[model samples]
Target: MRDMTGLEWFKSSYSGNDGPECVEVALTAEHIHIRDSKTADGDRLTVSADTWTSFLSHAVPRV
Candidate 1:
């Protein structure tokens, strides 16, 4: 994982304090960052903004 310093992370709305699964996301001008809420200092995946957009399109298509 990189420095990840200055990035603002937000938890998914679907996540809850008692939930077993938690995801955190951080958005930058050029990329999107994903990390496990359980391990803030653990591994993270970084993807290009375009790639994230593509993923969201497939994951939650418009009605």
Candidate 2:
């Protein structure tokens, strides 16, 4: 795993203030860190930058 000490995590802007299902994402040099905002101490999901870009591209299609 890569060091994420300096990674800046941001919650999805679309997420509501009291949203139950919220995710936090941090970009690192090697991979993107994804974790549940509700369970920050829980395990995280890491994905390569390229894969993350592709995933987002499909997850949120351009209208």
Best by TM-score: 1
- Cα lDDT, all candidates: 0.86, 0.83
User: Residue by residue across 1-63, what tens digits does model 2's lDDT show?
Assistant: 223466677887788988879888988787989988888778889999999999999999699
- Tens digit of per-residue lDDT, candidate 1, span 1-63: 235498898877777779757888998999999988778899989999999999999999689
Per-prediction CA RMSD (Å): 3.3, 3.8
Against the hidden reference, what TM-scores do the models get?
0.81, 0.79
Q: Which stretches of candidate 2 lie over 4 Å from their true place?
A: 1-6
Identify the candidate with maximal lDDT: 1
